[model samples]
Target chain A: MNRDALSAGLVLLLMAVQVTFVNRLPLPGDAAPDLVLLAVVGYALARGARAGAVMGFTAGLFGDLLPPAAHEMGQYALVLCLVGFVAGRWAESRPEAGLAVALGCAALGPVVAVVVGVVFGGAEAGVVALTGGLLPVMLYNVLAAPPMVWAATRVVRGRDRSRVRSRERGARRAGRLAGGRP
Target chain B: MKDTRQARATVGLLLASALVLMTVDHRSGENSPLGPLRGAGTAVFGAVEQAGASVARPVVRFFEAVAAAPEAQRRIEELRGENERLRYALAAQALDHRRSAELHRLLGTAGLGGYEVVPAQVIARRNVPGFEEAVELDVGSADGVRPEMTVLNGDGLVGRVVQVGPSTSTAALISAPASSVGARLEGSGEIGVVRGAGENGRLLHFRLLDSATPITRGQRIVSFGSQRGVPYVAGVPIGVVERVEATPGELTRIAYARPYADLTALNVVGVVVRPPARNPRDAVLPPAGQNGAGR
Candidate 1:
């Protein structure tokens, strides 16, 4: 339960970093990688679909309602909720799901965002927007997906590992206390 | 693990809630019921973003050095010192020199345009997966920045203020897919509309209202100014025409031009509180030959 909160907090902080640091990078094509989306994909891959969906919704609301956000209040919320679900489910089934899922979701995020933007927000889905804008962000996200996803999952999974270790140590201590034998 | 009904239900619920929120916000227009929530969010995240902006500055400088290496190489040569000790300091000094030069040119542009302005640094910028480009300025309502005020940089028109917080404001660049600016040909005074081509502000789409205006390559363009100049002031240099499209049967002639301001990498900007009494005209365009106006 506490692990969920830690993962969500990390993703929220990543959103802050996204708006502040990532977006300002002097990357070619003037498009920065979608660190927030990758963080969500990162969290979802470790946590299951249910937790992923909840965390995705929470982070999506944060992204949508954040200041400097000009789009309709739930555009990202809807897109990311679905994205979280897809990534979680994909990871759940394929035991070896790592780089492939991470990269797929990274690429999928921009396409879905463009679709959601065009349908609800009336955003440009034109050829220029695709070739110039979507391409770079997609490329950047794809390149960064593996390491970012690994980092995010490590934040969630690292705690679980430590908690299990502590529990095992507690069991050994209890056994020794009971009889001073093993 | 198999697909569980519980996970499916949770996803459904979140998706529904999101759609409901989008619908409510969309139907309400400018004065949405979520206004207060948005304000609170701005209060919180805006602060975080501000802190992040300071951290991003040095990193940006490093990248700018790499991106503009060819140009910086020439600058390094011009900045070379007689001794090796000072050579190590050249990079930092060059970066600082560039920043100060940007500020100097920003004020020079404002002075030439006769605009009363409040100077501000770009604190943060948000792009819509590359669709729209918006930047957060450190100045806000406290600095007399209201929605619709013209914004510019050292080069030329940057954008216009859209939303103002207590200590920060958001401005959408002239290159946003949704943005459109009224423009006039510098020499012929032919009227046209400048629309963002959505190519990351690398270029803009301009359509001359009069098909017979005889606009050729290398012609300059300036803002036509709105009534009272709410969003844009008159005679602010916009860009120079780079390519004129071949439109035989169209009512309006179309052309493409590069924006004057480097909308892709913004740093220092100014919000105009008051516009010039009279149009500054071509005087605002860099005094020939200097701006590479291609005579």
Candidate 2:
């Protein structure tokens, strides 16, 4: 109904999808597509910089709970926050541009993920392992993004239109009452 | 605007929280204040996971049904191959039984003891990528799965239980980089420390007790037992000698071994609860084997 409620519901849906189906989906190796990153990027692009950053942090926190290779906890949060900020800035400037933003966000998602994973995870992990593990998942997210964004846009716009219609009806009723009294 | 300031404040707070969590996670060894919180978080996550699984069950069932058609054909082919392998294995086992009976008769005359077997099931596997060589089992403190307990599968030594929890315990496989077992060649009686090499290979660094005792490839390596106590029972098959070499001036010989146990596909295991007594006359070497070899 409201923006906050919509965002909350979206976050929960994204987290649920990530932990359940997406995590279980067998990729090339043990890696899985990061649905939470996609959701964070999409949300940030639709909202502003601040909203994106906050959502990114929250999504990252949730991602930490998802099967981690190492014990390092908050690495995901830092990386996702950066991703959100970057995506949010892009969205703010080019509000109507969707594809370019989606591509850039998707591309950055796994790079940030790998970088954070390598630095905080352990000394044993190498660049080859990180690339081999994360790259395919990134590609999947990029390919899946356009349709996802389109659907999300449709939902948001439909809600906005309904709100506008109700506001217009209320205004008309108030005007009629005022004119009738005069 | 007020909203902008509130947004900034929220981001700041989130960052601070993340920092705190990271510090706590890094520093808080085995026992931490946040341990309970983590357990609680995992439980909550597990609940969400179940709900998500419920929602996706229909799709999963459909996929399974679709996949089963091709799988049925594959299963038929697989069964045929399995039948052939089983026949070969049965023949091999018959030969093994004959040799074992001969060895048992010899050992009985020599007044040596026999071995007992304990069975267990692998319950939990470590999901960590690099640490794929380890697993946690349902058998633990209650089931006599104490720390340093040697674990064996159907074939040979898998690893030892490093850490024991109340209901679960973590076992590092023989393939792990940190694992080393004191093993001696079955035929030659050449003693060597079987250290895990990269991948599935174990490097046997032989302590040259007698220069005359030559090592050979394909020799079965068994545990020599420790001086303090035989944590691993003697005569448990460790690995087979794959390669052997000697240098002109070197004090000892070096060899490589392929462990008998399959590091992967581990479903059931056996933990040696009571290890056999060690002979005090045996010399002690460094604790070479700790974890798997792959780093």
Candidate 3:
């Protein structure tokens, strides 16, 4: 499969796992980790801004369509897409995609989610709820990011090597030249 | 520079799409075109959830049991000493059985009514960034679970079913900020409304209708039973009064209650599918064939 298809398939599977099993897992309180967001942020950081944004939108759309979704349809979609775009853009500009950038994006996820919620008529999206859920979910994403990013990068690179031989060689040469420059 | 332009374009397009989707969904409400899509997703995911539950539960239990073994052993030792003291008090407390019986008669089954329940296991929880407290049940419309049905656990009331899909349903916990229920204080027979405090797994706030009515600490509270029992049923325990305090300028006193049902650790629960047994009209009307007896 191509990178696009592989990413899409992986994201779909992550969302399914999120709603089916991950959400039911026991946590410190009643809080459940946002596994979908974790996957989105990881993929975005490994890929670039455009890929991240697209992945975020697709994953968020799947999340919105999942059962027991009480919020507005596109609220999560908007928040996650922006998060992915921002994270990807940051990674693209930097020499390397740092863990701090991924963590920062995860932290921003809750603020964006709350803003979308309040704007979409969920007036009760106050400071308390934001703070209460943000820290834990952010921590969860950070903890899950390393493995997810590694897996996503491997899949994308594997697919790229098998399909676009010439583009793969060019990108590899560019990567080496950039590495050698500094 | 090219990368920057591409990033900006992608972000702008996706954001615009998201906003449009949200606008359409908000305006359409339940009639949103995505309803069918959501239903289909629920059906497929619900089955996946059932399969996952069967495999995951045993693994979770095994880990929890292993982790809790040491603590359980320590607790047992403490309980053994406490048990000896309790046994001594048990003899003395035997004389209070008559008073306990009287309280039981007044309270009626300690908040359990004569209604059967449908059992359901929690499949997923949709905290949704903690904006709402809701859980999805494995059973739904097919299983006779309907919106407004009362949900409870072994200890007390949990919440009510809010929305039902074909094979999965969502329940709003009583801890949600938007939820409120009529409550009755045990022993005092005083009525009040229990309001959600918005803190998940935290104490619920209750205010009596008549503030002057004396309510004390440790009093049990139960559902007052709504008309037709749509939201809550009578005789379902709510919680115990953790504390009572006077609001200096307000007439109504506020009490914080610790719910009996462990909302955070919920697994299996029972939904009250049938309504309460009595008819409201019976109170105002005479028995069958007795209307003309006085005349």
Clashing pairs in 1: none
Q: Which candidate number would show the highest DockQ if scored against the true structure?
A: 1
| Residues B225-256 of candidate 1: C-alpha lDDT, one tens digit per residue | 77667788766778889999999989999998
How are the candidates ranked when ordered by DockQ, highest leading? 1, 3, 2
- TM-score order, best first, reads 1, 3, 2
Q: Give the per-residue lDDT digits (tens) of candidate 3, residues A43-162.
A: 776677888898899888877766666566777788789888887777767725457777677667766775665566343543445555556766676677677665665666654443
Q: Pairs clashing in candidate 3?
A: B111-B235
- Write one digit per residue (lDDT tens) for candidate 3, span B1-295: 8878877988899999988988888788768786677778767766776676677677666655775787999999999999999998998899898899899899876534246678998877765554556777888899898878999888888899866777778788876655678888876778888865544655677888887788888888877776677778775788889978767667778887888888766789888887635543333222322211111
Tens-digit lDDT string for candidate 2 (A1-182): 38646765676677666544554443334445556667677767666667778878876776554321124457678777878777877776676576788778877777665555446543234333344434555677788778766565445444443321134645776688799995
DockQ of candidate 1 is 0.50
Any runs in candidate 2 off by more than 4 Å, and if so which? A1-6, A27-31, A66-70, A123-125, A151-182, B1-13, B47-74, B78-295
For model 2, what share of native contacts is present?
0.21
Question: Each model's TM-score?
Answer: 0.79, 0.55, 0.75
Candidate 1, overall lDDT? 0.79
